[model samples]
Target: MNYLWPILILISLLFSIFRGTIQDINNSIFTSISDVVTLSLTLVGNMCLWCGLMKIVQETSIIKFLNKLLNPILKWLYPDSKENKEAMKAISINTISNFLGIGNAATPAGLKAMEELEKENMNKSELSNSMIMLIVLNTTSIQLIPTTVIAIRASLGSPNPSQIIIPIWISTIVGTLTGILITKILLRRRKI
Candidate 1:
């Protein structure tokens, strides 16, 4: 998969060059580079804004309240982490940030959660059920807001960027739920 993307790009560039469209290829490459820069700048502002909000939430009582709500689910998924407040707290923040669709904001909390979870993993060579679940949750994050997508749409001049909120929420819910269910089922099978 890592080699596929570069190989594909190289093939496309070579093909275009061979077709006597070197100027077009050059323009396209530069244009893509410029677009990437523009997109990064756009995302940075949104990420910063959301990250600040997340920090404020973390500092407030709201996170504790959310922690309580999410605690049961985390406990079930990470049995050993039930007594680990640090891990639970990190998981809470990561989950909430992902829920709100601020994935950039979720990263730090996710990393923190993983680090804390790692400390509890008795066998350093193997991944725990909780760790696998955490990876699934982060990768297939449940997005209630999808702020990043909204930001991109707005940047592209969409008049109804927020219209996708419900769709995103629904999709993420299904995705997360399915991922968790599958993980749990597999874990049960492994135990047998």
Candidate 2:
């Protein structure tokens, strides 16, 4: 992976040189740097805003409300960790963050949930069922809002950034369902 990128880049540079498009490459590099900086600032602002909002949600009764709503699904998804309050709480927070499409904000809660799950793990080196479920959930996060993507599109001067909402909903729902179903199938297979 480390060598792949440099090799690909070198090939691109060589191709551009041969095509007499080196100047175009130079222009693109400079333009891309500026664009990257602008995009980074926009992303940072959105992350900060959402993280702060998440903090507020955590401190208020909203978290309890959300936990109550998500409890049934969470219990079904994470049978092993259903009795562990800390794990359940962390999982709830991570789910809320992912649903809001602020994955960065979910990192802390995800890590905490992992830690809690690990405590119940019988084998020190092996993953617990709950841990695997958590991994699946995070990997196939089904976002309701997808705020980060919308922010990026809006920052890039999109006329209607929210136009992707329906597509995102469809794709994420399919991805999440597939991930969960596969995980369940694999886990069941392992048991027998």
Candidate 3:
């Protein structure tokens, strides 16, 4: 995977040079890196705020209450993970991060969940259904606040950064539902 990127970059650079678009390529690379750095800073700021909020929620037992409230749904989503508290904690944290629109913060938790899931698997090399479902959920996770989007809008000098809240909420909910449905259908088909 790492080698594939450098090869692709070399190919792109060669193509640009051949087409006499080296200047355009250079400008695009600079622009892309600048945008990445700006976005990274914004994400860091938003994630810090959300992580602090999460810590407060945890300290106040809000997270524990949420975990209890979500037990049924979690069971259905991760039937094989019933005995694993660490995996459940990681999943809960990942879910909280997604709900708060802190994708970067969610990554480590999601990775930990996968590692836990792998540990519990009998066929060590094969991913379980719960792992598959977790991946789908993470990919199309529903976000309420979309702090990242708002931060990007603010950074880009939007007139009203929060104006996108409703649209983002609606889209994320719908997308996540669709992803869940598709994953279930695929899993069912694979069973037969």
Candidate 4:
């Protein structure tokens, strides 16, 4: 499957090189690199600020309070792994990262959570319900702030970059609820 993608990309690139204008490609490449660098800087700046806030939250026992507050929901989502504290922490961190709009940070924590869950599982081949729920939650995560999008908008010189906040919040909530509902329905169907 991966080989097919590389082959297809190679074919397309060769075709473009042979038939399409090289000048256009060069301009696109340069523009893309510039955009990437600008975006990277913006993301880094915003992430650092969020990370600092997260650290303060953690140090002040806000994270522990949050964990306690979320315990019931977490238990429901991860019924099979209720005793796994490390896994729970990882899951919380992953969710928190997503809430802060730091997807790049969330990925590693999500992987760690999965690894911890895998350790507790007796059946290595079969995924746990917790794993499935985690996957679904991560795929359509709710974001309180669309930091990356705001950064992009600012970089593009938008007059009101923060104006997207309400719309993004609504969309993220809808997307997350839809994803959870669909995943639950599919899983139930599979069981039957």
| Ranking of all predicted structures according to lDDT, beginning with the best and ending with the worst | 2, 1, 3, 4
Lowest lDDT 10-residue stretch of candidate 2: 46-55
Better of 2 and 3 by lDDT: 2
* lDDT of all predictions: 0.83, 0.86, 0.82, 0.81
Best by TM-score: 2
CA RMSD, predictions in order: 4.9, 5.6, 4.6, 5.0
Model 2 gets an lDDT of 0.86
Q: Using alpha carbons, what is the TM-score of model 3?
A: 0.68
RMSD versus native structure for model 4: 5.0
Candidate 4, poorest ten consecutive residues by summed lDDT: 50-59
Q: What are the runs in model 1 whose C-alpha is more than 4 Å off?
A: 1-63, 155-159
The TM-score obtained by model 4 is 0.67
Which residue pairs in model 2 clash with each other?
none
Q: Write the per-residue lDDT of candidate 2 for residues 2-120, one digit (tens) a residue.
A: 89999988998999989999999999989999999998898787767765776787788888898899999999999877898878887998998888876777877788789988888
Candidate 1 RMSD computed on C-alpha atoms after optimal superposition onto the true structure: 4.9
Give lDDT tens digits, candidate 3, residues 104-190. 778767877899888888887677887999999998888878777799999999999999999888888899889888888888898
Clashes of 4: 0
